[model samples]
Target: MRTVDLEVVRGLYKKAGAARLKLDIAPRFKPGDRVKARNINPPGHTRLPRYVRGREGVVERDHGVFHLPDARVAGQDDRPQHIYSVRFSAQELWDAEAPSEDSLNIDLWDDYLDSA
Candidate 1:
């Protein structure tokens, strides 16, 4: 049996860390921008949640560039896109009877959102 070296594993993790930090492109929406999630129901895999689809929210923060998971899963190139934390009120996502104080925050890629 072949034994793996600890240093080799550490190097692999280091490379991954560097890759995650590489934000070469500019972001479309900034913090406080209003955006809506696209109502796309693709037959294939997607990182977007069903509840968030067609919902409108305010951008809370920018998470910088990262690989688009939906495309990556399809054996395509790592097409990095800006990810943002969007805040949605309960009333915006659910029925009007939902608690006014309740809200949801989700991290969404650029492609999933549109200017609201």
Candidate 2:
């Protein structure tokens, strides 16, 4: 592993705290595209919400490319890909508990989703 200079990082954050990377990668899922979150159970760090796993949703918008923490935390190669805001209906996620008129929008990585 390599050491990251804290001061250098801090200097860059003087303007904004945004972690969004400027990459010219093509987005896998576009707005209005139907998608499903992958049902995964890895014994490590992940950003995927447990409740959203195995559930289907629509891509609300693409948030551009960023490093996938799952791979990095596993001490593997970094896979930077597009992250998207996906909108899931309450009925689809919570069944009968949540109101049918309600919905949830979650930011998810490309690796965590599949064409539904």
Candidate 3:
């Protein structure tokens, strides 16, 4: 199935997509909102990994604000997103073998979480 119209449309999109762009990102939450990492898997992709999913964590810090990523990169979305440092106990992220006296600092975007 070859369609000249389809090919032309695709080529036009490819040309328009080469332009550099900028965006504005807004903070997702206040200082104390609780959020959990998203749990998902897709073929041929590298993400935050499996050990941190579904873990309960607190918003320990905020990094002001920044622009969200876009289709040019993985998990990229052009939107205002807040960044935060979420803290999780080592045991929560890594079960039995996790050390008792340590916690992990995970930097996450606003879209990567929700009220927990």
Candidate 4:
């Protein structure tokens, strides 16, 4: 099985409206909920970064459903996947000096997260 790159997926969507891409995802979590990215390195590939693995964060926003992408790459799939904007405190994401109120927001796929 081969995986497509995010650039290609973006190009497809750019050339052909979102109609070419199917949007679907079932959300099991909501805003203000604590969650962590799954800690699994599939043999093939994944989009979830190693840095984010096991990192704790809070769900801040929901981007709704969208085409599922291969974790390693950006190939589109018919499967529904929930996209969430999670906020990670700068201090939490990195074990360094970070403003208590500073945070980073990231768009993560459903499979990349689990209840914290």
Candidate 5:
């Protein structure tokens, strides 16, 4: 394995730690669109949090296209897709006793969601 020295790390994070790319790919969702998180459990690296899987949320923002981290980790590079901020009510993720007015926003890739 190659060691990442300071110079290499500096070049890798030149964008201030953002992997965002300059692409014109169309987004799969938009704000106000209801979506459901796909219950996927691949036998490999994934950024999807377990608590949010199979939950419903509203698309809050389109963060543009970027390479899927999971895909990259699996050696399938070039899998670029739109990432969105999805908002879920605390009650939906937890229980009815949770505050109804409270919601949590999590950034999710297009592959992780479907129209609700």
Candidate 6:
């Protein structure tokens, strides 16, 4: 077993501090745009919640570019995409009897959304 020195560990961390994705393209949907979540069930890891699948929502805000977590987790390419805050009415996601006034906000990447 090799014992790594403290200075080497500190240097490595310093070089990798808070890395963020770099993207030159702009986001697709902005705030107030209507969008729908794609109904997908990949065999491996995914960040999209099952409850929000195939549901419609409005884009609430642009959260900037980020490395897609799903791909990264599966050891695939860390594609940078714009993330947005999507707001969905409780009634739309749950049963018809759910409160219409209530809403749920979820952050989703671009590839998971489509025009509603």
Best by lDDT: 2
What residue pairs are clashing in model 5?
none
Weakest 10 consecutive residues, lDDT, candidate 2? Answer: 9-18
Which window of 10 residues has the lowest lDDT sum in candidate 3?
16-25
Q: How would you encode candidate 3's per-residue C-alpha lDDT over 39-106 as one tens digit per residue?
A: 65544433355676767778898775655453225565645556688888888787757888789988
Comparing candidate 4 with candidate 5, which one achieves the higher lDDT?
5
For model 3, state the Cα shift of residue 25 in Å.
5.0
- Residue-wise C-alpha lDDT for candidate 4, range 3-106, written one tens digit per residue: 88897777776554453234444587899899998888876556677778889999998878765556325454445677889988888888678878888888
Candidate 4: which pairs clash?
Answer: 24-80, 45-72, 46-71, 46-72, 47-71, 47-72
List the global CA lDDT of all models: 0.89, 0.92, 0.67, 0.77, 0.91, 0.89
- All candidates' TM-scores? 0.84, 0.85, 0.60, 0.70, 0.86, 0.82
RMSD of 2: 2.9
Local accuracy of candidate 5 as per-residue lDDT tens digits, 1-116:
68889988888856673778888888889999999999999988888899999999999999888889899989997689999999999999999899899999999999899999
* Model 2 alpha-carbon drift over 4 Å, by segment: 1-13
TM-score of 4: 0.70
Ranking by TM-score: 5, 2, 1, 6, 4, 3
Q: Order of all candidates by lDDT, from best down to worst?
A: 2, 5, 1, 6, 4, 3
What's the alpha carbon RMSD for model 4?
A: 6.2
The clash count for each model shown is 0, 0, 3, 6, 0, 0
- Which run of 10 residues does model 5 get worst, by summed lDDT? 12-21
| TM-score top scorer | 5
1-116 per-residue lDDT for model 6 (tens digits): 65889976787766553445666868989999999999999888788999999999999998888888899988989878999999999999997899879999999999899989
TM-score of 5: 0.86
Worst 10 residues of 6 by lDDT: 13-22
